[model samples]
Target: MSDFNSKHEKVAAKLRNEITGTEYEPGDQLPSEKRLCDYFKVSRVTVRHALQTLENERLIYRKQGLGAFVADTTLNSGLVQLTDFSEDMKKAGLKSSSGLISLDKVEPIKEVNEILQLRPDMKLIRIDRIRFANGNPVAFDITWLPPGYGQLLFDEDLTTQTIYDVLEDKYEIPIQGGSYRITAKNADDYIAKHLGIAPESAVLEIDRCSRTTGNKKVYFQKRYYNPSHVSYVLELSRNDNESMSSKDGLPLKEFSPSFAK
Candidate 1:
């Protein structure tokens, strides 16, 4: 029932199934390009693309001079702390900078109301900027602020400084807990141009809503990151004395067993 337009996707899906079903186990060599072409009755380009799709998913890996092989399945990062963007870059030894794209006071939109608990007529200061690491555009951030905070953006140079720093130093906004959701998306024309990637290229989009001790939502931000450049990592440990593996064979190492002695 699949259509012609989804030919590549269909092939990719089938290839993924084969990988999951152990048609090719970890460390097992994949068939050569010509062999894959013959088996799938597809062109070399199609086969290569299928493999590339798997590579991106970390389901398979290519070894130099050796054929592609199934990757050792492992759990990715877990959700934990809400780290500051500028601090993360600094720790990575990357020269981080921000360029102000726009700053305006606008009436809170419907989505803003839900995220920030804004009143019906409340206004907000919205800032859009490009965050650079090592002078290369890595993220496009649009940050929203509740009213009065608009003053902070005007007196401080948000372009060359960390927003978190400005918030703490000038506005006295306490660094409190926040929540974030991350997912993969394709870049649109605007994002593509800004990030220097082709339209529809893969991107990791993070939606974050931060609040203070009083639960006052001060910042709601949308960050679009280039997956090829940066990866988000979270460290966790296991606490339960259960067996190491689950019914699905996933490890039970969810929390660290020991604290600092």
Candidate 2:
């Protein structure tokens, strides 16, 4: 059993190297369990454990009975500074890519005007994208930018990169901070089709309005996340007077008095 553990670790190490080195690029399927077992001279259970470790690391992904595949590298920008989907996925160890769904200059609709704090007659550049992690669609993002930002995107490839990175590196827009709103919603038909989920499935909806130190609105976006594939985590403080809840918000535990207090 000890030997088995070591072999599993070895297999996992090699697989990690392959993934990080891009030996297995995003969207590439990994070898089968049987094949890996043969190569590593390990038992089926050992191979499975190795694969599970990789999955936990978010370096690879498994579909029900479909076999394992290299996880699409993504930037985990949420853990760091504010970033665009394209850039965040890249940092999160998934290959970030995007396809422009649409781009148009339109008068601020009521919702857009409210979100951006714009006048009803304000014209904004709206860009919509279907963002992919390892070539699998995972998010639908719609961004509204004020026109004064000056030719915000140089090319549609901006979808494959982080918007904040682009703005900072290419355009020199520095992000200081912003406000965010997160909620849950049933996936609409469009979201279901793009994310390969059932219609009416629960999904995470994030709306953000970000700005630079200069008080210029850098971007306002609404992102739809596939609930099964991602979850939002909040690190909150719990005073003695507060409470804890299950992920679904059912009450769980009441905070107790502090030891020193």
Model 1 segments beyond 4 Å from truth?
A: 1-79, 241-261
Give the range where candidate 2 is weakest over 10 consecutive residues by summed lDDT. Answer: 252-261
The residue-by-residue lDDT of candidate 1 on 171-246, one tens digit each, is 4455556777889999998888788899999998989887764677878898898877887543445434343345
Give each model's whole-structure lDDT.
Answer: 0.71, 0.69
- Cα-based RMSD of candidate 2: 18.1
lDDT of 2: 0.69
Give TM-scores for every candidate, taking all chains together and pairing residue i with residue i. 0.60, 0.56
For candidate 1, what is the TM-score?
0.60
Question: With candidate 1 superimposed using the best TM-score fit, by how many Å does residue 95's alpha carbon deviate from the native?
Answer: 1.3
Q: For each candidate, C-alpha RMSD in Å? A: 21.1, 18.1
